[model samples]
Target chain A: MSAPKPSDLAFVPFVSVENMMRLLHRIGIPDALTGLAAYIEEDFRRWELFDKTPRVAAHSSDGVIELMPTSDGTSYAFKYVNGHPKNTRDGLQTVTAFGLLAEVATGYPLLLSEMTLLTALRTAASSALVAKYLAPDGADTMALIGNGAQSEFQALAMKAVCGITHLRLYDIDPKATEKAMRNLAGHGFTLTACASVQEAVEGAQIITTCTADKQFATILTDNLVGAGVHINAIGGDCPGKTELHRDILSRADVFVEYPPQTRIEGEIQQMPEDFPVTEFWQVVTGTAAGRRNDRQITLFDGVGFATEDFSALRYIRDRLEGTGFYQELDLLADPDDPRDLFGMLQRANDGAA
Target chain B: MSAPKPSDLAFVPFVSVENMMRLLHRIGIPDALTGLAAYIEEDFRRWELFDKTPRVAAHSSDGVIELMPTSDGTSYAFKYVNGHPKNTRDGLQTVTAFGLLAEVATGYPLLLSEMTLLTALRTAASSALVAKYLAPDGADTMALIGNGAQSEFQALAMKAVCGITHLRLYDIDPKATEKAMRNLAGHGFTLTACASVQEAVEGAQIITTCTADKQFATILTDNLVGAGVHINAIGGDCPGKTELHRDILSRADVFVEYPPQTRIEGEIQQMPEDFPVTEFWQVVTGTAAGRRNDRQITLFDGVGFATEDFSALRYIRDRLEGTGFYQELDLLADPDDPRDLFGMLQRANDGAA
Candidate 1:
């Protein structure tokens, strides 16, 4: 007799890029961003239970490939991401990613997704979540210092999660600023195309620096940063790549995701090894203070963390049910008799014959 | 105008379980086994060039999930594998896996394939490859002490790669041995369902122990092993899951792949630190000797490594060309302008409308 057909356990739920886009649009981007922020905030609040590790990176001359993994005892997730700043010159994305979430009990994958889109969403959600906790009350206007791929998501997430209504966008390339402005046109925000970083931060309550340069160029010098503004420094995410000058970090009451990782990859990579910083989870847990006074610069060194990816994947897994936006991929081998893998192959061969 | 269709760069070739079995059967199992052995040997010979790291593992009460990643300068490969022995009780395979091969320069994935079958094939091929160098001359009869998922593949690989044509199989459950005998019925082998391990080892020139128990168990006792017989111990791949007895390891001239990993996961984990073990690559490179004497007990402590998985993925990638067994998965988000990802999403939204 031919081998029995594989069961549902053999198939993994796979969300392709098209499906991910469809799902986000189905849920409404603003609502999805708000949902992701809630999930991230919840995960961060219980951060003490997570298995956190600095991303395992393989660095080359041109770029880096990394595996960021985290576990919350019941579920596990990991994202395979690559950052190649030079890729844009070849008409490729500077960053590309995919992720998987698995059941911790059986060690079987539950979902496989193209995380290029999800990473963009989650990174923005994480930024907005932090801003909600630390930004001055009723913060509305923001300066977005990088009008690249992630800029629009940041702007919308800030608006949806933090009630920000105005965006001042700036980039070295005029075309990039024009692209961001176009993308945000109908998104219900008063958008500005600023000529300089100095002009962008003029009357804004929040400053989000998200440039994509790989070097340690100071996009936001100490002279440009103003008091009472919550600075979300995102671009300085790797060793030797800090967006802000050292003076801003010293002046700001810095908050970070995970200290061990932030010390190496976040903006704190520029500071001394023993530099004082607050873990964001502590602020969420009410163990530490956030934005004590209006004059205090609460700089969130927002290097993307594995837990954030885990939270994003968790959110996706939750939203995937009852939705026709995913495909079942025959990714696992589930023989009727688990011990008879070769026999299963032989039966397949016989069926083929 | 509608959004431009995704380019070829946005698609990653995915080979599912059905296709992997079809590909293997199309190539012929024996030839594929030999081919995989060749690829593994070639990678082993250049072992120094690989970025080797012990698999990153997350351990739970029941099992472990692991990520094994390696890069050989031009290409990078990683395998996601999980071993939950209890899974077999639930009619799931004890291990399931999937792997990806990507170009290191651009970090763009070239191929994604189901690896549960590939893993079985590779492990068997690796065992037979080692046996080729160390087994006594003109050896044909071999005792396979574990009749689990990997047994028949081991029997076939030995026949294809080394000139072994006879087999003696034994398992704690007599049904397991019966299953193996039935599976290998017409595979050009004289198969025997031995009553015990002692009966299985009778007059066998090679003894292969591959039992899968989470705890330490002496599948092969020191007194049962005879001189000049090459012993391949494979099942002791995790921290506490060893098969052979401690005395047998001390008596044998041990060979290992990547000592750092082998020492922690191999049968040699029972032995002390700084135990004398020969790196198998040295043997492949003609620097280390195999089968030094007729009476010497040569044991291959076969713990799987990332480079071996890398080689398997490399072989799959090379063979996937021109084969219609793969489907293109829209796994990457490729915006027209890398910096205008939001604009691309907006255009996709417009197209959907």
Candidate 2:
């Protein structure tokens, strides 16, 4: 007799890029962003329960590949991500990613998904979630200083999570601003394409710097930032890649997610080893102060933590439950007899005959 | 009026479990085992160039999940594997795995393959490769202890790589030995099903111990082991898990894959922190001796290493070139302009329409 087919336990649910987009569009980008933010906030409220570790990175001559892993008591998650700044010249993305979630009890994978789009979503949602606890009162406008791949996501997430309806967009390449403006056209935001960073931050209460240079290039100087503004610094995520000037970081009361990671990868890398900063999770849990006065500068030095990716993976797995948007991938080998794995392979040969 | 399809660069070649078995069968198990051994030997010869790190592990109460990553400057690879001994009670394999290969220059993944079968092949190949260097001259009979999933592969690899043609198998459960003997009926071998470990090792020059237990249990006592024998210790691969008696270790000249890892995971974990052991690569490179005389026992403390998986991955990627044994997975997001990721998401809506 031919070998029996692999059991259902052998298959893992996989969400390809196309399916991820369909799921996002089905949920609507704004609603998905808000939903992701809710998960991030919930995870943050119980942040002490997570097994937090800095991402494991292997740096090559041109770029780096990293594995960011974290786990709650019940589930474990990891994202495989790479960043190569020079890829853009070859018509390739500077960043790409995929991720997996597994059951802690059995150590069996539950879901696998393309994390490129999901990463962009989670990063934006993380920023918006933190803004809810840190931004100034009546913050209705945001100055988006880097109009690149992440620009439009940041814009929409802000509008969905924090009710910001106006965006001032700026980029070194004017085409980038045009691209962001075009992408965000009908998203119910009043978009202004600005010529310079100074013009973008003119009357905005939230200034987000997200340029994509590998070196320390100042996208926001001290003069461009004002008091009572929440600075969402995104581009300065790797060591030696800060975007804001030292003067701005010096003046702002910085908030960070996972201090050990932010100390190495965020804009706070320029600060002293012991330069005091409040953990954002504490603020979410109402233990730490945020935006104490109208003149207080609350800067969220966001470097994108593993817990955020864990929250994102959990959110997608929950949302895709009955959607029929994923394919079952035969990624595991399940043999009837646990001690007979070779028997399984031998049977496969007979089946082939 | 519609968005263009994702470019070929966005697609990654994926080999599922079915295709992996197909590829192995197409190559033939004997030849594939020998081929994998050659690759492992070749990589070990140039071992100094590799970036090696002990696997990053997440240990829960039931089992452990690990990420083993390594690079040879040109390419990078990692395997995600889990070992939950209790999974067998729930009709799941105790171990399952998948792996990926990526370009170090571009940080883009090239191949994703199910590594459960490949891991088995590589482990057996690694054992036989070491046996070639350390097994006694004119050795032909192998005492295969613990007739589990890896038993047949080990038997075949020794035949292919070391010209062994006889097997003496024993397990605590007689049914396991019956299964192994039945599976090896067609393969050319003089199979002897032994009731006790002492009976299995009689007149045998090579002894392979591969039991599946999560705690320390002696499979081979010192009195049962004779002179001029090579011990392929396979299953004592984690902390708190060991198979051989301490007396046997004291009498053998131990060799290991990577000391930092083997010290914690291999049978040598029973030894002291500063215990002297030879690096196996040194033996392969002629810097250290393998077998000295007819009376010395040589033990290969084979805690699986990342480089072996790297070799297996490289072998699969090379052999699958013209086989059409893989499917292209849309795992990456590629936009016309690298900065237009949001635009790509927005245009997917247009394409859907």
For each candidate in turn, give its C-alpha RMSD to the true structure in angstroms: 3.0, 3.1
- The true-versus-predicted C-alpha distance at residue A194 of model 1, in Å, is 1.0
Model 1 residue pairs with clashes: none
* Runs in model 2 lying further than 4 Å from the true structure: A1-6, B1-6
Q: What is the lDDT of residue B14 in candidate 2?
A: 92
Real A-B contacts recovered, model 1: 0.74
Here, model 2's chain A TM-score works out at: 0.97
lDDT of 1 by residue, A1-353 (tens): 01223377799999999999989988999999999999999999999999888898888888888999889999999999999898899889989999999988888888999999899999999999999999998899999998899999999999999999999999999999998998899889998899999999989999999998899888999998788989999983778898999999999999999999999888989999999999999999999998898888999999899999999999998898888899989999888899999999999999988
Please write out the lDDT profile of model 2 over residues A257-297, one tens digit for every residue: 98999999888899899999999999989999988999999
Model 1 misplaced regions, further than 4 Å: A1-6, B1-6
Cα lDDT tens digits, model 2, B269-346, are: 898999889999999999999999989999999989999999999999989988999988888998889999999999
